[model samples]
Target: MAKSPLFERGMVTRRAVLGDKHVDGATARKTDFDDDFQTLITEGAWGSVWSRPGLPRRERSLLTLALLAALGHEEEFAMHVRATANTGATAEDIKEALLHVAIYAGVPAANAAFRIAKQELAKLQEAAE
Candidate 1:
């Protein structure tokens, strides 16, 4: 039997983009109320746009960070910003994005993103060194 397209593609893309440990941890945390939210995001966001080949993963990561920063979605922004370390987007890349956010999305938005990104980047740096 063929695997259902939704489950197979999303699981593959989700694992690829987020890493096994992250996805598995997310899965472990899902409750009945949030399970649908999890599935929707994994199958839609990860399985669809993130799986697209139009951009390199690093470029996509940069774009995701910028949009999240611009929108003031602090929690999601920080999560994606932290994912930058895994995607080879450095702290400098995040700084550049925040600079753009300051110009277009307002200074306070950029300032908050930078503060969060700094903590996240510091964690990555410590993990590396």
Candidate 2:
């Protein structure tokens, strides 16, 4: 039923988890030049690891957000922050994770993540209301 054991769920799980716009934007950016890189991440990060069943989706989402935040990946952190809502992690959970990141990853990284999360979360909430 599933194609990729890595992304076995196909783009469905990833899209539902990460949002269509973000995933589509990423897909649209794929190029023959970057085909290898694209395949690597698609099969490795998105398909392989994220597809694993060990951790609950929310826990995986939380860990991903924290890692992205701490590593100073602003856009990625922002995207994952948005994904948290779908993963059963609340906005408050994101706040807590970022606060922890601030303490561990330094203020600048956390500050940027906060701003991004704030903007994205606000957008998501506005859509809901």
Say which candidate scores most in TM-score.
Answer: 1
What is the Cα-based lDDT of residue 70 in candidate 1? Answer: 83
Report lDDT per candidate.
0.82, 0.81
lDDT of each residue in 1-101, candidate 2, tens digit only? 43455554536667768888978998899888996776677777767677778988888898898899899898788778778778898888888988999
Candidate 1: segments with Cα more than 4 A from true spot: 1-3
lDDT of 1 by residue, 11-65 (tens): 8877766678888999899999997787788778877788788988788998999
Best by lDDT: 1
